[model samples]
Target: MINDKVLSIILGGGQGSRLYPLTEARSKPAVPIAGKYRLVDIPISNCINSDIKRMFVLTQFNSASLNKHISNTFHFSFFSSAFVDVLAAEQTISSDKWFQGTADAVRQSMHHFLAHDFEYALILSGDQLYQMDFNQMIKKHEEANAEISIATYPVNAKDATSFGILKTNEENVITSFIEKPKADLLPDWTSEVSEEMKGEGRNYLASMGIYIFNRDLLIKLMDNPDTVDFGKEIIPQSIHEHKTVSFQYEGYWTDIGNIDSFFEANLGLTDDIPKFNLYDQKQRIYTHARILPTSKISGTTLNKAVIGDGCIIHAAKIERSVIGIRSRIGKESVVINTYMMGSDNYESLAEIDKKKINILMGIGERCHIKNAIIDRNCRIGDDVKINGGKHLEDKETDTYCIKEGIVVIKKGAVIPKGTII
Candidate 1:
């Protein structure tokens, strides 16, 4: 059972340079996913589902959209003590600097966290996709009597090098921590683990970056002025001094750290049997419900596509795509293997015909966009082709960017007719 003694802190990331133009106008958590939900919604919804309602999201980057979305979406009943809040980085008398790193962000916001009456602090990442009942993790923390409990996932030898590896005692107390060790160094470290501990045929235990810390221990660890990052400086140092434990988790988890990962995750949602199920009624992901009309289409062929509300389509062929809200697809357009984030506002045909704006608000006629990401409020003219060549290259331009062969049209960009990539 969850009580009011726990406080959840979600680390909304910094400028999110890896996500780039998607993060151009908004923070990474504010970036839309699954067509309807923001990235921040995932962690917050998980907290609510776990009956852990006292939460704070810490962000220092472009936070306008993130703030607006959180304010509009989560509203607890007045009779309950549950609430979700945003703690943007501010310059106070005690600290004049911005958030230096993950731990530093928590350190700067420690004052806000201290004001609340909570015994345990749950730390989460804002840009991850997974559904976890943190109540179980809290229970494990209580059983182990641990000062710090890390949620870990098992990975095969091939993928273990990319993550921070863990070695634990028979009781699952973490004995050592290694961040992104080489492949050759991993076998020696993981070989020490017992077969019973290596469940699911995986040889290595990787840190999920989800942690449960005793409130006092978190404060004590953060008091160190030099510990800026948890994985790099704090956790590695605390393993010996603190009662740290590991909770092995078996579930689907993806970190949307870069463009390729983000693209693949969104596209993976359209699978016949998606690894991450958004349609799970028991643990539903919450978002701001936009009161818009149902999407309308005429003579269109859509295959395994997820379209959002208030979209108007005219004879377009869309396949394996996630179309966002307020999208308008013109006649004879074909969108395949793309994540189309639709417009914020609607531009009627009359508005377009009157030349109120130079370009339309959505996809123009006779466009062929494949394996790309069309960001919010883009204006693609007719006869536009965005299919990159067979070979991948790291390319960038004023109107678009091609990272790992996935072309991304910039937000609110105006691409002229007859353009090709």
Candidate 2:
């Protein structure tokens, strides 16, 4: 069979301190991306598209929103075995501590996975942006008779420092591995990449942190509690003892590890043709099916902008931005190089007029926002100017925070009129 019965284990990352403010209220998997879908949707949708539907999302911190999103979005037929469940960390008699690392999280949740019948385990990272058909990777694994298969991507010397580097033999069997090799060692780490990649100076094969492990081997490895992380400890130790294969993926895959990379990845969608293809019909990025009206715009000149459903945009000019669902941009406001995560729900005009609302849930009139991320349900008063750049120091307040020169207005924050950042 081309596609076999497989289980997917999505590792919801730790506290997510790097993507803070966006991850302040929710877990990493639940953080909204590309205007609509959550980060977890990338892996789950890939599994669904590949006909491997049974999946579990492992998370520990702030999983309320994640739980809500999963429940509200995915619905499988009762007659079928397909399921998408969110598994949060729980205290058991054997171990009571929280998830220490990636491997430990799966080790704790192995009992749940054992109940399902599967020959292979497809493990994925929660915070990543890509569209892939995992069936191809599985086919390579089964054909190679491999105990482990890792999805590897060719990255340059500068990008190699951030990812785990892998070395494969002539037959594409992984011979050695190194975690975040320094730039000085990159000269010796160059591998055989495609000519296109060679021209781009991307020679080192970096682990994409996407792995496929045989069911029996995964069970055997889980017995040892010392191995905490797959990148730091597990893969490096197992490659020598077991047969491991490298599955090279030369596509638009990005690790949403920090604010700077996350910002760039979201804004990159505005390009003429984004590397991350969201419009692919076969490989769709699934998310919540919200009942929202069509977006309404008046006097807004949108250039290279992506607007989601049910938005009321009256901005004078919006250039190179992603306006999310149910967003409201006021008259004469200009938004550039920003990602505005739309509100969860709409505020009625009656409620606003009766109470004489001070600030509305969206960009206010005559505002200027550039190089910033306005989180969900933010209320910015009129005449607000937020220009995010390297000139400002990193700081955080009750309403908003600045990281890597990007101003992130906190969720549900209200900025007073005439405020300047």
Candidate 3:
């Protein structure tokens, strides 16, 4: 099978400054999403469903938690070669610095990749939310005898400016490329999309930043030290010289590039029919198999809410929210439009009763939290009111950050009683 001859490299992006406190302790791929799963799970699960078992994730900053997560989550038969390995930026005899860019990361890690026997490399971004069958893309690449294949998505003109636009010929072969082209330049950059996409005013094809490179070609490109990025340096320079084709994909794909996008992606799971389907059994998202008790709720009126395992709730109402594992909400609390990442462990009731701990690791009584993200193991005191909206200005405190009206309580933060934001 072609899958056996394919290797996957998922790029865990740089410092992730846009994500702020969320990325402070972990790498971008290690950042949690949809309550239960990490950002890296999306790409790895896609490869698993496609039967591309052997994979490597490359990350540089704050990779300790990322490494630990992968080590604990993915396990295969002892006799099989299936494995997922993380390769952080390392100092070798040739280079002594961190990974400069996407291409440089691969270049620095080429020694490990070359040790494996593979004909093609399926490069993917770790921070994207999408499900795709990579087998079809590989098969198409073989049929076209293309040296490189890029996944493209049809987006509207308004969104085209934010992405690297590709111009393709009638054969679906890329002819030219422009990175974040101006609005006036979009008229010439439109590509052939399906009737459904055209009707949706999605005539422009945006590069999805997913690519497949023939092993030999990737090796050749990596040798050039000057070229340090795929989307900026490799794709544009190689399109006219190499047989590069575009694989147009029409699906629910969103890049978790910033706090706004990340927050929206999680809350979208609460929709009646979400664009990104998490309930599809055939294409299920894989994650750490934790042995946890079933979530328990009382006096909580849940409407369009997704509660994860091992939650103990007493909230008056939870609407349009995602409550994560081991979450605990107190009486009369009203939580709306929020993503509450649950605690890592239940605080010993004995400790709380003994007053050994002042505030417990959960929301307190009579608190009203809206449009906020309470990260893992946060402690909220009683009678607190946090109303996050566009009316709030962007600011950062020791325990929380306000960005675009979303109040993100940092992990392990302690909020005093009778507080308001």
TM for every model, in the order presented, reads 0.95, 0.98, 0.99
Estimate, for each residue in 182-260, the C-alpha lDDT of model 3 and write its tens digit: 9999999989999999999999989998999999999999989999999999999999999999999999999999999
Report the error of model 3 at residue 301, Å.
0.8
Q: After superposition, how far is residue 165 of candidate 1 from its true place, in Å?
A: 0.8
**Worst 10 contiguous positions by lDDT, candidate 3:** 1-10
lDDT for predicted candidate 3 compared with the true structure: 0.94
Whole-model Cα lDDT per candidate? 0.89, 0.93, 0.94
Show pairs that collide, candidate 2: none
**Model 1, range 1-421, lDDT digits (tens) per residue?**
3469799999998899999889989999999998889999999999988999989999988999999999999998888878888989899998999899999999999998998899899999999999998999999999999999999988878778888999998899999999999977976657334465466557788899999989988888888888899888888999999999998887889889998899989999999999998889878899997899999999899998999999998847999999999998889999999999998898777887788776688898999999999999999988898895447587888878888888989999999988987
Off by over 4 Å in 2: 1-4
Put down candidate 2 lDDT per residue, 186-207, tens digits, no spaces: 8988888889999999999999
Candidate 1 local lDDT, residue 265? 95
Positional deviation of residue 85's Cα in model 1 after best superposition, in angstroms: 1.6
Q: Highest lDDT among the candidates is held by which one?
A: 3
Model 1 Cα shift for residue 306 (angstroms): 1.2
- Superior candidate under lDDT, 1 versus 3: 3
Return whichever of 2 and 3 wins on lDDT.
Answer: 3
> What TM-score would candidate 1 get against the native?
0.95
